[model samples]
Target: MKKAYISLLLVLVLFSCTKTNKKVDITIPKLTNNPSWDVVCTNRKPLLSFYISRGGIGKRTYIVNLDTEPEFNSPNFIEYKNIEELDKFIVQKRVEKPLVDKIRYYFRAKAIDSEGNESKWGYTRFSLDTDYNKNFMNLTRAKVQNVRVSTGENPKNLIDYDDPGQVSFWQAAPPGPIKPWAIFDLGKPTIISRIWMLANINRDNGWLVDFVWEKSLDGKNFEEIIDAKILNNDTFRNVIDITPVSARYLRLKINHFRGVAPHLNCVIFYTPGKPKVPTPPRGRYVLLVGDQMNGGTFTQLAPYIETLDLDLKTLTVPHYEISLDMLNSILII
Candidate 1:
């Protein structure tokens, strides 16, 4: 037993001496957002940051791994090797499959020096969760119940989504004041986190260049939240992040416009948390119009047909153009 113990001690002493002689002892890279990162859930493409020790010689090669499974053994596990940079990887674009919503994701990284010395893996876990911010001004939900403008042509067009191209916009009527304001009424009080505005880039001075955001619980009383004057005319999209506030009415007051009229193409109000996604209908029910067998008009019977949890599809094509593929997709004739 003493001989065996001495032999083990000799091996340990040699190993310790060899390890100490090495110039670079590569330790695990420190992950900046370990455990959990909220940005991964909110950003479609998130940038990962990390720190590597200073002792590694020559160019460092980073290996990054991402997987849906915690074990990182899934078929979809993605590996990126030979990366020269220590930070900034756009994980979304490189993913093999679309990241499913509300699914936990695993990330790990390691570094190897030119001399083949390697570091321990640094790991993190995050999820593209249900806490995504959503635009509440969607036309489908009719969230912007009503809109009243101080002076503009078709203020309702902002929420109607009727513009075929970029040609349509809400502009102050000619001969009216260059300053125009609009108030939006959400049917119920809603918590708003941010606002997005896309202006017409064609008109240099017609955009919502200078405006103020105001909110009110009652439509009558309003308080200003932001007074913005955009100096960069090159960009069309303007986004403003605000502390989340609940209000029933939101207002946008234009202070100055240099062109013929104050103009804006689109506006979006964002609120935290994703809305529940409705299940897609399994198969479509084709309604062969002009046939006497289907007696009711489309407008009157469309709602009733959807109650069966089936999608309604109207055959707008000529009888000769009706193909087999179309018929196969429909559940009912």
Candidate 2:
């Protein structure tokens, strides 16, 4: 029609002279800054060490577990094209939530990009205490024999398991050290929630004798409750939780059984959920035995111990730091 309108106006003037100059837009910045980074040790377990600012290039890092709220893609969190990939994405930012020696868990992390826009949520503010295996309930018994502390000096009260009277795994020492003690039974009334002792000294080094434990819910009124410190003998593993207390005959009264002799092997107990209780019971249970633990284990690892005697019930002296200050005042960090 007129040379087709001058060949479409010379192809729109060579595509506007090759987009005239230039304007690029891929879009990848919306992590709205927040983690300026500088929280080394929130004391014991709140780790959130950050500081990845070459700003204007971060790619993605959106890990959200806030308690299994789930969503962790993790492409090494794709820091981006330099600084060794944000130093391998800040040595791979970690987000592990598992703690319950008496119930403790808190988490929060956000740093999104790929064009979704995020980054305001940041918290590694301590809440993973580790070792309260479901508020510890049910199991009633975890047998690990090796008792006979007779009377060295750990008992000023309840010692009745069919009349255990004035319980005493007692230990004052210097008389005939055969100290190795252990006794267990919770087969049914467990409201307990913590008591773990796993040690490993290797190399015959002796001098271990630390105790102090007393508990009973029917075995005849006992109540001393943990006192002999200084243990962690070497391979380490010592956890005690009795904050809930509703036991049913668990006695270990050797309050001062030192190393090099007071040899106990291992002892563990943490019950509160899923030991399988729904068949003929009302609720809360774990007595039959066999499911050692597999239903809400924030952290359960054991090895060696030589005289654990734990009745669990301790809180004072960083005793879970007031539940980590109520999980850092309800996550504001």
Candidate 3:
């Protein structure tokens, strides 16, 4: 009887140990955007998406939390519990709350299965600032003090004006074995956010093909910021938004193009700051509107323009400063 009792006790102890050692198999959620190193710098809410491994056929629950601190100890921290039909949710556009400006907020999310198994939390952080959203000025017009090119006539024409309406063009004279290149001096070390190019009006096929945009601080040493190649020329403007870089000199090296000579109409660079108010128009009666990408609105207003005998001028923001020629026109906000 004593031996049998001891055997039963041993069996119970082994079962208890095994049960305690068993691990819960839960699928942890993955945060797609707003990685740890990247600080989202806009007031506009960013899309949040998540992925789950071994997504079962059944429904799942997602728990998202946000806090101002990394430890997530704030009493004002927000939590969202959503039951999703799919095992994964992606690119969610809305957020429950608005983040305060200048505050760095931490984000975390976890997943729970139908079986009540919970997953570990994934984490990220983001911040908000109006400085990131403000319309920046064209530095090529305001900052570029000098222009130089390896093989071109009147390189100053590239920086002479930011207007696409200009007739002057700096052309890469052909028959020379050397590739065409142009350098722009920004006067000082300035942070460049975007590069805008106007298609050459001289030739229909004179669009830029393969080129590299490089930057230099001292004007002696340089590094490439953009390598532009593929193009879909739907408009007269080609704008390239790059990661903000600080440099005193910007160089454009033209590798190849469609026309006999590489013709450059205008090249403008923009940096983050308040954009200058456009020069007001004088003595002309034209209705001005901001850039309309698809021209659907313009098509609808064609009848109105014809009836009013009004000249229509469409100006792209920051690229073309806002100025209206008044026929006592009402500027649409």
Candidate 4:
């Protein structure tokens, strides 16, 4: 009886050791590097990448979350499960929210082991670097040569949409059955890939409007490149993609709800390459003199004052109000 009791005690001890060895505790994963992120304004989407020092288990996955705010605790956060799905996300790059021109976005990632153990969150942020002023067809580079209707309130406000302090907008009033339209000359032929339009939010329900964008190599003959109606639920900006067309002239015809004319805050054009710098004319030139009230005497005396070479074509206007057609003809200006 004593020998049998001792043998039972030994068996219980061995079983307890076996159970302890089978149970393994999991360790949290460590972040190896910061996330890889990029934003493309033309695509209107941002790309994100995640990495860890090592997944807790051999077969592991990840969870990615995106938010406008830095905090990741919101219930409305956009989530993606599994590493394979997260990696495949680049192919179908789409932003849940319409991206503002220069707004910042926040992203975070967490790793999950095969045993369902999750690591702490890793964070990253990115913003779109879209500067409309740098665009090839901006007001600094191009001009609104002619329009079907005259300016409604401020004459210069048609193209001066970049000013943040003023409530400057372009509007056409009365006697128009068709939509109001405007024509812009880019000063010279440029390769344009996209067009961005920001509507006047205060007037005429800017978010609800249809636009027809047409491009022309010569001002007379125009070809419609985009005709789709953009319906914005919450966004203020509308981006239109077009085939890379070498055009010097572009026209935008606005169709608004009811008979109310469309009000535009800003319009911008984007090209792939850098802005074209005018080459110096290689011959004798003449300096056409204009009114000296607005620095006209200074304009006439500029070439002589600077002792410019006779071969160089130098025209200096104090007001810099040269017409787009004249600017295009004289490339050296």
Candidate 5:
């Protein structure tokens, strides 16, 4: 027993020495203020993986983030105690499929290290996998916004979407109804999650706006998704949160305006919130339009957008035209 214990101790000492010799020690590498990054998706969700893998040996990790806005932005300088918790692998996780859209996105990639340092190789410009089996579907979709609306001089009751008179494609607004214009031909039914309204168009430095939003699957019968109203809110065009509401049509009902600078710079629609069903893989989400069915009207959503998107950017290729087999199929060939 005594001989065996001695032998074990000798072996342990040798193992420790071997480990020490093999370790490639590194001091906290001075972060060169430069940031390197790559984007990847395991489940179709995009993750910005940042890094400062500059002249390093082994892959050491750290933690980072914007302290001001925790929820909006995630920490890039992050380290994981548990490797399992680390979303280190770049996966194309289509856990929640993106909403149907015409505009699309490709791919991006990033990297990070032990020190809270970042390198910038960001936002499009990722290497592709040529291997067929390992290839990823590298594209995104969004409706191209084309319908432009300016204020008019008269106030009309836009509360009635059922009436064709309610909306007039405006070049300019009248003195009344507060130049209400919004583009929501987002293709598929949206569970609107974010609303960014910017009343920053007036050059005169002051503006007041009262706004309400309504939505409907069948454009004729619209209802307010969020009853929250902005009464003379002096906002200089900012992002607002519109909760998850399932609808295809959205109306930005604006009434009672004052002050100046009432221009909408942009309204960016974010990904929908937690949906009812597990989102499918990121692919083409098709919606059939054209209710002109055999002298019958099915009352589909207004502003059939797909046709517009295709029409505006139709390629002069040899592909056959989209026929009855596309939108509304028929008993006849």
Candidate 6:
């Protein structure tokens, strides 16, 4: 009985020693590739590749986090079983929230082993360059050299509307028999794609006005590009996208104001290529005359006027009557 009791004690001691000798894997995986100074486009999806120091250690998955702030261990961290899964995650993020220009993206990655032990977070960063503005940079800025108004409280106030600053505004007087219109000379012939206007009706007064944008290769013969009605509740910045048109002069005609004069803050014209030819007003011309002058008359005449386009004002008078024989002889009328 004493020998049996001694043998049982030895067996217990050997079992305790064997359990204590077992090894636990607490090794943290090291990052092999840490990217720096990587530039990516705002419109494109960037692929991030990383390497782990020990791939054979039963690494089951990776935990990836991308955010403007560095919170690696947060609940929002994305998990991936492999590199292909990580790529899919990037594609999904891009579809949800597109990366914006001039912004930095932070990326953190960690490896999780089969034993559920997570490695230390590895970090990298990438930035979006301003190269996305290449399309805008190629276009030229159209300058407003001259401003003419049919009727206004202060004609000189029209100059303030050329800049985009909203501090000052140009106010036109109440429309009379002749509609209040503001004509602008862009100083040169340009191929324009877009026009932007920042305007608002006078405060405390709700009013609406039909704003017409007319473009002219010559100062005299104008063609309408945009005919839009603007209300007091409309946005301050109004953008008009039009097919590219070559023009030297642009006109903003206001169809009779409702309550008071409409306030205009800025007018911007975007054109492609460099300015080579200067467009100046020589005189007005009579392209076509109907029984009465109205908006419908101009819209109907746009197709004909576009065909017989001219760079210089050929007419010396506001109204001119030419016979069929004389019209055929004139190159531009």
- The deviation in Å at residue 94 for candidate 3 is 34
Q: Name the runs in model 6 displaced over 4 angstroms.
A: 1-138, 159-165, 201-208, 226-233, 256-258, 273-333
The TM-score of candidate 1 is 0.41
User: Candidate 1 vs candidate 2: which has greater TM-score?
Assistant: 1
lDDT-wise, the better of 1 and 3 is 3
lDDT of 3 by residue, 85-127 (tens): 2424442435656666677778888867776667788876666
Candidate 5 segments whose C-alpha is farther than 4 A from its true place? 1-171, 177-179, 201-208, 260-262, 273-333
Whole-model lDDT, candidate 3? 0.64
Error of 5 at 185 (Å): 1.2
TM-score of candidate 2 to 2 decimals = 0.23
lDDT on C-alpha atoms for all candidate structures: 0.63, 0.39, 0.64, 0.55, 0.38, 0.55
TM-score of each: 0.41, 0.23, 0.41, 0.38, 0.31, 0.38
lDDT of 2 by residue, 1-333 (tens): 999999999999989988763433332222222222111122222333343322322465444343312232432221222112245335233334322332223344445544544445544322233332323334333332223334434322212211122122232345354543444655556665666654332322332445656767666677776542334333234556565566666666543444424433345555544332223223332222112221211222111111234422211111111233333442332
Weakest 10 consecutive residues of candidate 5 by summed lDDT = 313-322
Query: Candidate 6 lDDT, tens digit per residue, 139-221?
Result: 44566788888866554454553223344656767656787777888888877877766555234231334667788977999
List candidate 2 stretches off by more than 4 Å.
1-149, 154-190, 196-217, 220-233, 240-246, 253-321, 324-333
Clashes of each: 0, 50, 0, 1, 62, 0
Listed per candidate, the RMSD to the true structure in angstroms reads: 17.6, 22.0, 13.7, 16.3, 18.9, 21.2
TM-score for predicted model 4 compared with the true structure: 0.38
What is the clash count of model 1? Answer: 0
TM-score of 6: 0.38
Q: Tell me the spans in candidate 4 whose CA falls farther than 4 Å from its real position.
A: 1-155, 161-166, 201-204, 227-234, 275-333
Model 1 bad stretches (over 4 Å): 1-142, 162-166, 174-178, 227-234, 282-333
